[model samples]
Target: MAKYELNTKEQHFATTRLEAEAIVTEAKEDKHLIMHKIAEKHNKYGEYFLVDLTFSYNTPKEIMGVE
Candidate 1:
């Protein structure tokens, strides 16, 4: 089995790097968010690589100053 980690401030997990990349791409394109960073990482766990993503956008809540 393979595991990957994704982060957009919060964290998500994927089974493959491609899947994680897809998640970030779709969010930026479809959802119109700004992608700050996209990367792949490998740790001591072995052959599996983790995908990391960072993005940002202004939400209606932020504009409205909701708390």
Candidate 2:
């Protein structure tokens, strides 16, 4: 996969992503126990776009404030 580098300004609007997974014996279950690993990346102040990577199971839990 190709990744775009993060610039300084756009870093402020960055989102969080991490490697995580849920396991369940049944596949049809609507929900599985969700767990996330502890890892964080800071967005720089000069970047023009958002974060540099896309990930799985990544969602906005809450929007705290604007950049």
The candidate that wins on lDDT is: 1
Q: Candidates' lDDT values, in order?
A: 0.53, 0.26
Q: Which segments of candidate 1 are over 4 A away from where they belong?
A: 1-8, 30-32, 47-67
Candidate 2 residue lDDT tens string, 1-67: 5333322211112232211112121211424223212234344643222322222332333222221
Model 1 over residues 1-67: C-alpha lDDT tens digits? 4332322453455667777777676666745344434445566774443444454555555645743
Q: Give the clashing pairs for model 1.
A: none
The total number of steric clashes, by the backbone 3 Å criterion, in model 2 comes to: 11
**Structural similarity to truth (TM-score) of each candidate:** 0.40, 0.17
